[model samples]
Target: MSFIESLTLMLALMYIASLSYWSGKKWGAVVTLLLSIGAVAISLYWPLALALLIALPLCLIANKFAPEEFKTEIKINTLREGCQQLLALSLFLVAIQYCINAIQLKQGSTPWLMRPDVVDAFLPIAGGIELKAIVTLNLWDQTHPAAALMLAAVLLTGLLCKRAFCGWACPLGLAGEYLYALRKRFIKAELAPPAWLDWPLRMLKYLLLLALFYIVIGMPSESIPYYLQGNYHKIADLKMALFFVTPGLITLACFALILALAAWRRQGFCRYLCPYGAILGLLSFASPLKIRRNTQHCLIEAKGMKCDKCTRACPANIIVHTKTTVRSDECQACMRCVAACPKSAALGLSLKSGHRVSHKGLLVLLLLALFALPLTAYLAGFWHSQTPDNIRMELIQVIDRVGH
Candidate 1:
């Protein structure tokens, strides 16, 4: 099969599976299994199969050994967080290795995984800008298929589960959340910025987004033709990768600043500085699913005090107890609020139709599906850049020379 054909089939299967699962159909598992088999058949890849094999038993074990409702939320959230951390750390190490391998590769050989570029590929802003440049400059030969695939995956996640990517997939977010947790446990206090300060700070990302769009799209037509021919953007991507792989003093300082801020306030970067997250937050409003509050069941009013457990647990710091439906663009759908609610069913993820989504297993299944589809396409030799090896080698050489 052609690469586009294989990619289309994989995505179609994923959509079917997601729809089935979200609609509470019993055939969700059947469709998922079919997807697994189809992926292996198309890619001739064993990793997807092996991953599914391992995950199946783990999911079963989690369901079988499930704790009481009160404990279930924490345990599941912890497990999810651990998985995010492990994946992030593993990917970081792999990126470092990719850089080393790039330096050592023979002139004609391409790296198998292209790990250094994966994060860039997944960044919608970067991809969207590149795509626009390609179209505007009529540079069909300079296509970035990997970036396109990543954008598709991200958009799919947004449509299906809102900002689940921020809570469950982003490595930077994992680190931020861990820092926030440490602050909560060790410092035993919340340190939120005042609303007057916080509200304006949140506008920074939107401004950054606008600035980037202007730079990419508002360039003079005469200069754009020349700009596209130059390797400016590719070099910028390499610089970003190099910053993470071998942190200079400035990069280290910036990393420290982010950690310190996260320790002071939960998801500080996500709230204020992530341009990519800003886009997702806006797109999340189109989502049909949301965290709904069952105020009638709430115990806080009975006790003549605010039971702000749900509010306190929200990583986005949204006031969950007051709203019948959480429509905040900042909501990550992390389910911490649902778990933190002492009263059973006080907070639940529900569709607009009022159908409550209560199963932890389904969330796990959705996460697995999100990860599995792109991997299958990648293994099938569909989701990668078509950049010439000579050009890639030259770019690496430039990065190595300038990075030092």
Candidate 2:
């Protein structure tokens, strides 16, 4: 394994170990510690090996000194946020690695750094087209197969676990969390729109989803192969990076608008603008797992008490108390409702068959669904790009002149 890969793995293991220690799970800590040791042993790099040795004891010391309340509350939110941060950091590192390779390729030199295949996740439009080609022509994407595979992985996550990907793994969702936090701090309110306007705004993403599909699905199957092999599609990731790197006035305006909206109303961009989230939301309807209300255990139903903690805690504003099963498309399966319920058994994520999934179980399932396809593809030698470096070098030279 490369140094970056080994370092990322070591850091991820150590992060899990620290979280487990802080969350008071002895077994988790021990197992992760062993894994961290394995990572260090295989790393072979002295600096990382030394850092791991130091980090483990420091984590132990930090855990020992943490307050009792701190330990208790570091359960659900901590696990979810930890996963988000880890995934986001991984993407950021992959972006950096990608930039290094792109820069080298542009300079007419073979890339010294390994180009990360996962960066293809940025090319969802291409993925969508490639997926269509796969379905229609049985042709796998040779150019950026990882893109289609990653899209499939995400769809599987949505199909199996609702919008758990959005809640537990999305980097944008993490950013949205911070934006909403800022809103709470500065604006002192959610500033939610009235239902009359909110309902239509919520439909925006679905409309965007429709528009995206209209383009992808309408393409002639014969055209897909040509399009996928085209110069524009080949270097789509570079173009994507450039958009962010050299944002025009309209791009900046759109970003500012999205940020402002996210701050004004929780997950504003996700709730209304993210076509990916919209697709997931629709696919999530098929998921057997959902946040279900237990009437027998609910305080309002069982004890004649007024309680709406679950509803209030929900970021998506689903009326958790009223629904026997939260069937709203907006529900992200975030478990904030479950976490906030005063009655321990009042609200829980359960299958239609009444089997409950523990928080940890959900996390595991989400991770599996999110990575299984890409991992399988990687193992099968289909994850790496088949495009030649010579071709890539030529494309990067005239990337500014190439367009769809």
Candidate 3:
């Protein structure tokens, strides 16, 4: 996007976010849906006839779920009930964008992947938190800055609202969640990742985090972007082609294999493998906005109803089910538990206006250090930018190994 277009989007989002924050109207959600629609419309790749599907979000506006969070609660109106569905609908429009690209690729209408013009940041890739941060720090200049800021805003919202963006803002995550709804019927039960496996999986992201750092800090910084730029082609394009033709098809095969694992373990990939999620989990810690627990009205003193639904619905397997108060980094703020609790167990989301960050500066510094460490590594020659020709191949192999 150009400077003016970028400014317009930022102002629009800020106006909408603040409007929702202050007025407590449903307009915030509406604006969010509109922006997603606007994003789709901006592409203009979709058929004009498809605009008729405005009914998708229209239906969502009618089905909003009540909040019902506490004893005297601020329940969402009808619009909240179908927020997820509307979000999914908006994202489905984005999938249309992706499908257009795929179609263009097949028809020889365009050379997309390696084509700097069509490839780079033009594709529909969102919900990757690390990618967001990297772009924020200007690590990926090729990325659309407006989109990056929009993503950052969404991430900040998630920090404040507990993964609200995962369910509401992220186009890609919406696709996954929608697919999971269908996949769930065929599966048995959801299990938290086991300690041994889960522990190892957590390291994968942390390691990938460090690897990104090493490439940035330890490698020659000038060389790093070339590596990233080239690898963008390899992963997004070369890999797509090789998926059908290569002997090293295990990587392509892993996509389905991971989904199968998710069937057994709900959000297994999200829980343990997503580097973007790991960063958010870290940054969100110091987020002044936190979920407030209504300790006085909790379940231990009450009857039949307790905190069963929130934790049960938690993809992160947050242990809200057993606790009077729970504030783990793993919480996604999906609001399943908030909406699911029978007694309205006093669990409420809090909009923190201010807090004591000075006392927590050490931890805040740690998060910053964690972020800068990767960039330093790129400039310093610790990453895999040693050879430009093979950097793309190497990064994929690295990402595949670590992402799995």
Candidate 2 Cα outliers beyond 4 Å, as residue runs? 1-74
**Cα error, candidate 3, residue 20 (Å):** 4.4
Query: C-alpha displacement of 144 in model 3, angstroms?
Result: 5.3
Show model 3 residue runs off by greater than 4 Å.
1-81, 98-155, 158-162, 171-196, 216-219, 224-248, 302-309, 321-325, 343-345, 351-404
**Residue 82 lDDT (model 1):** 62
> Between candidates 1 and 2, which one is better according to TM-score?
2
In candidate 3, how many Å is residue 52 off?
15
Output the number of the lDDT-best candidate.
2
Candidate 1 worst ten-residue window by lDDT = 1-10
Return the TM-score for candidate 2, rounded to 2 decimals.
Answer: 0.85
Better structure of 2 and 3 per lDDT = 2
Candidate numbers, best TM-score first, in rank order: 2, 1, 3
Residue 306 in candidate 1, Cα distance off native in Å: 5.0
